[model samples]
Target chain A: MVGTDTSELNAARAALVEALVRTGDEDRDAFRTVYRLTSAKLFGICLRICADRQGAEDVLHDVYLTIWNRAGAYQPGRASPISWLATIARNRAIDWRRRQARTRAVGVEDAEAVPDGAPAQDDALLAVEAHARLHHCLEGIESRQRAAIRSAFFGGLTYAELAVQAAVPLGTMKSWVRRGLLALRGCLDGDA
Target chain B: MATPDPDPDMTAAELALGVLDGDERAAALRRLVAEPGFAAEVEWWRDRLAALFADWPAVAAPAHLAARIEATLDRGAAGGAGGAANDNDHRWRTLAILASIAACVLLAVTTLLMLRPAPLPVRVPVTVTTPPPLIAAIAPTTKGAPIAAAYDRASGVVRIAGGVDVPAGRSAEVWAIRGTAAPRSLGLLPARGTARLAVPAALRGAMAAETVLAISIEPAGGSPTGLPTGPVVAAGKLSG
Candidate 1:
C-alpha cells in the first residue's frame, strides 16, 4: 500500500507538469486537462485565504488565466508544479484580502478562532515524505511560534494582524515568526 | 553613505510566508523578474515552506467553473488572430496577407490625410486608426519544413504550428532581434505542436517591422549565460 501510494503521488505530479508544458504550447485540451487535475486544490487554497466562496471563485479564475500566460516561465527543476500553482493562488488570495482591507476591517477574533492543529486530510495530495518531514520539524518549534506561522499562512494575515490577534507586541510577533522560520529551515535542510 | 542591502534570506522567507505588505510585495515581484539569483532564493523558500500546507483539504470547485474558464479563453481568442486556430496553417497565412494589405492601406490614408488641405471636408472611409498587426513566416535554415510560425502584433504572441524537433539532450530557445541590436531571449519554444508565446513586456516595443525572430537549440533548461549559446535553426522577420 505504501509503495502504491508513493508511486501514485509521483505519477500525479508528473502528469501535472506535462499538462502545464502542453498548455504552454497553447493546447486548449491540455489547458482543460490542467484545470481538471489541479483546480480543486487551487480553489481550496483560495477559499481558505479569502474566506468567501464568491471571492475564491473570482480569484480562481484569475489564477488559471495567469497559468495560461505564465506557464512558459515554469521550470520543472526549480519547484514542484503544485507548489508553483499554490504559490500563485496564495498570492492572488492575499492580494484580494489586501484590497478588501482598504474598505472593510478583517475581524481579528474571527481569523484567530480558526484551529491551528493539523487537519485530518492534510496529506491527501501532498508527498507523504515531505509531509512527515515538515510535521517532525514543526514539533521542534514553540507552540506560539507554530501557531503564528500557521495562522499567517492559512489566513493570509500580515505580521501586524497576527500581532493584534495574538495580543502580543508587533516586534515580538515578528521575531517569533522569523526565528521560527529560520529554525524550520535548518531542520528541513538537515534532513535533506 | 549608501544604504546597506537587506538580508536576502529573510526577505525570501517573509515573501514566502505572504506577510509582506503591498509595496514590499511589489518590490519582491520586480526582483523576481529582474534578478535571477534573488528569484532562485525565493524559489528555494517556496519549495521548503510548501510542505506546511501538504494536508490542506481539497474541496472541489463549482462544476460550472471549468465551463466558465473555457468561455473566457474563447472570448479572448476571438479578440485576436494568435489564439484563433492551432493546426490551420492556411488560416494564419490568410491573416498575414490581410494584415499586410491593411497596413498598406493605413499608411496610405495617413499620408493622404497629412498632405490634404486642413479645411478639406473629404473624410476618408477607413475606420482603422491603428496599424495592422505585424507578422512573420519563420523559415527553417534547411529546406522545406512542415512547421508554420507567425507573430501576431495585436495579441503580442508568437504562434507556432506543427513541430520543430531538437536533438536529444538539447532544447529550443526563442530570441527576438531588432536591426543591429543584440538578440533578446523570448523564453523557450515547445518541441512540437502549437504554442502561443506572449512577447515579454520588456521587449514588446522591439516587435516591429524589420525585427527578426529566431529559434536556437540550447541545453535543457535554456541558455545559462543569458545569450544564445547554441546554433540557430530557424529565423524570420516581421513583414507587415
Candidate 2:
C-alpha cells in the first residue's frame, strides 16, 4: 500500500465516472468509444484468472454490455468508474474460476503478452508484507488447517486433493479449510 | 454431551471464494442462498475478489474487434435484408408456379373429356351446303349482328362455304360464343368468297353447355364497343 495515492488512482477513476455521467440518448458514440478502449485490458484480467482465452473474451463482451446497460447505476465518490468496471471484470473471472477444472494448470507461457517487469522496491516490499501477514495469521493454526487453506487459495486444489496431499481424511481437510478461512478472516479484521 | 449444531450456511463465503468443491460446494452455495445473511457474506467475498483485479494494467483493444462489432450492428440495422430478398424471390417463384398449375388444370379437363370411357358418338349439326345467301335471306332476323352458324358436334368442325357482301370499307368479322360477355374474335371474313374457320375443341360444349356462340360484324377495324354493328347474315346451331 506504500506510496499509493488517491490522486493518481482518481485520474483513471474520473474518466469512467465522466463516461457514465455523459451516457445518455445522444452519447451512444461515447459509450461505444469507451467499450473499444477498455475491452482489451478487461479481457486480459479475465483471461489471467480463467486461463481460457475464449471464456475471457465472452466475459469481456458480457461485461461491456452490462456496463452499457447499467451506466446510470454508477455512483461516483464511492469508487472510481474504472475501479467499478475492473471490479465487474474480476467478479466475472472469480465466478469462472470455480467452473474451471484444476487438472488444467495454465502455464505462464500460454498467457498472451504478459509484461516482464522489475518489481519496484516499494511494490516488492508491499507484496512481501501481504504474504507475511497471511503467513503470520496462519501461524497459530494446526499444520493441517494451514495446509488446507493454502491449497485452496494458492494451489486451486480441492479439499479431496488437499486431504490426499496431507495424508489426512477428506472430511477433516474440509473442516480445517473452512474453519481456517474463518479464523484467518477474524485475524485479518484485527490487523485492519 | 451437547449435540454438535451443524452450520449449514456458514460455507457460503467459502463457496463465493471458490473454496468449496463438487457436491459440497454446490450444497454450500444452495444453503448460503437459502440464508440471507450468508448470501450477503458471499456477496462481500465477490466484491473483495473483484477489487483485487483492479490493479491490472489496461490493454489497448485490437482494431479488428471494433470493426467486427460495428459490422454486426450494421447487419442488424439493415432489418432482415437477407430474409427479405429470399421472400421476394420466393414470391415471384410462387406466382409462376401457380400460373403453370392453372394451365395444367385446363389441359387436363380437355384431355379427360376427349378420353371419356364410354366413347359415345357425339351428334353434331351439319352446315346446309345450299344454305340461302347470307345477306338477302338471313339479314333481317339477325338484326344486323353477325350470324352464329351451327356446326356438327359429331363432325367436330366448321367450314364457311360462302361470304356475305358488306359495303366497301366494312369488313365481316367472326366470333366464338363465350357466354354473355362480348364474343372472342376468330378473324376477318372474305369479302365475296368462302372462308374456313377451325372450331376450337373447348367450343364443342358451347351450345349444350348453354353457352351462346354469336358473331358480330363491325367496321374494318372491328367493333369498338366489342358488340356487333352489322346485320346477322346467317345463324345456326354449332352442333352437328
Candidate 3:
C-alpha cells in the first residue's frame, strides 16, 4: 500500500467537511483550494473525454463550478473526496461530448483546436507523480486488457468500434474488458 | 413481471464503456438500477476507471471561461438584477448538472420502480406541418417527448425536439458522424427543454446515404472539434 500520512489525510477531510458545514455562502477560497488540488487531474480526465486541450479546459471550468456548487452534497463515507471529484470530472466530460454532438447539427465544423505546447519538465514530473499516486490500481491489469479498457474508457470507442480499431472480434474485445474489469475490481477492493 | 436483473451486457461497466448509446443506454440504466446489485456495480466501476484519466492530455481553457464562471458566481452572489441573469446563465448549466443527476436519479428510480411498471402518462397526439414533404414527415416525431428528431431530405433539415437530461453544470450537443469522413458537430441542444436542430447542408447527402446520428455531452456552447470530444450518449442511423 502507498504510505500516505494519516494526519494529512485527516486534515484534508476535516477541512472539506468543515467547508461543507459552514455553508450559507459558496466559499470561494475553499473552492480555490479544491480547484488547485484537483484541476490538473480533472483536466486530464476532461481531456480524455473531450480529446483536446481547449475542450478539456472548457469542461474543467464547468466541473469546478459544479464542484463549488455541489460541495455540500459530498458524502465522505460513500466515496473518497477524490472519487467524488473524479465522478464530477467524468460526468462533465461526458456531458460536454453529448452537447457538442447536439449543437453542431450533425456535420458542422468543430470549434478551434486546443493549442499544443511542451511543458516544463517539472510539470511532467508532477503529472507523473499525480498519476502514479492516484492510479496505482490500474497497474494490476494485464497489458492487453489494460489497452482494451483504455481504448474503450479513455478512447471512447464502442465494442464494435474497438473491434474495428483493435482488429479483434467484438466478442474478444468484450471479454478483454470483462476480465480486465474483474481484475481491476479485485485490485481496487484490495486497495480499499 | 419484476424487472429482470440487469444482464451483464447492460451493467454500468458497459455504460461507462459506451457500449450502450441513446435509447439502449437509457433503457438499460432505467431497468438496471432496479437490480439490487447495480449500485455496488457502479461504485466499483467508478473506482476502477478513475485512474484512466491520469493519461489524458491537458486542456488549457481560455481565460474567458474562468472569467465567465467567476462572473456567474459573482452575479449569483450579488442577487437582484445580476441574479436574474445568473439564473438565465444557470439554465445553461442546469442541463449538465441535471444530466448527471438524472443518471443517478434514473438509477435510483430504477431501483425503486424496478418491480413496478412505470405509469404511462397519457399524451395528446401532436400535429406537425412543414413546407417540404420531408419536413412534414419529420415534424410529428418531435412533438410529445422532451426530445424529438426528424430529418427532411428536400430541405436538408434534421429537426430535433426535446432536451437531454444534463446535469446542473453540464450541457448537451448533437453529433453527426459520417461513415468515411470525420464526425461533425451540429450545435448545442437544450438542456431540459425542446429545440429544433437544423442539420448542416453538407451533411444532407451523407444523411441520404445513411449517416450516424449521435448526441454527446459538451460544454455549454458545443465542442470545438467537429469530432466528438465527449461520450456518445444517444446514437442512431439517419435516413433521408
Off by over 4 Å in 1: A1-4, A72-79, A108-110, A113-125, B1-9, B22-37, B79-240
The sequence of per-residue lDDT tens digits that candidate 1 reaches over residues B116-173 is: 4577475655885555667777777776673566677666777877545777755688
B69, model 2: CA deviation in Å?
4.2
Candidate 3, residue B222: how far the Cα is off, in Å? 26
First chain TM-score in every candidate?
0.87, 0.57, 0.64
**Selected candidate, larger TM-score, 2 vs 3:** 3
Q: What are the per-residue Cα lDDT tens digits for candidate 2 across A1-192?
A: 335444544555566556665652326677775675467667766766566766676556545544543443233443334445655676556444433433344442233333322222222112333434554676766766765554444333455556666677766666677776677667756876
User: Comparing 1 and 2 by lDDT, which wins?
Assistant: 1
Scoring only the second chain, what is candidate 1's TM-score?
0.46
Candidate 3: which docking quality band? incorrect
CAPRI tier for the interface of model 2: incorrect
Instruction: Tell how far residue B182 is off in model 3, in angstroms.
Output: 28
Best by DockQ: 1
In order of DockQ, best first, we have 1, 3, 2
Better of 1 and 3 by lDDT: 1
lDDT of 3 by residue, B1-240 (tens): 332332234356776555555555555543432332563455446554554443445544455655666776776665421332344454344443434423332222222223345669956456534433232122112233333466765555567766556555445667654543345555666655555555533334445435556666543334322234455556566543
Reference-based lDDT, residue B202, model 1? 39
Alpha-carbon lDDT, every model: 0.66, 0.47, 0.51
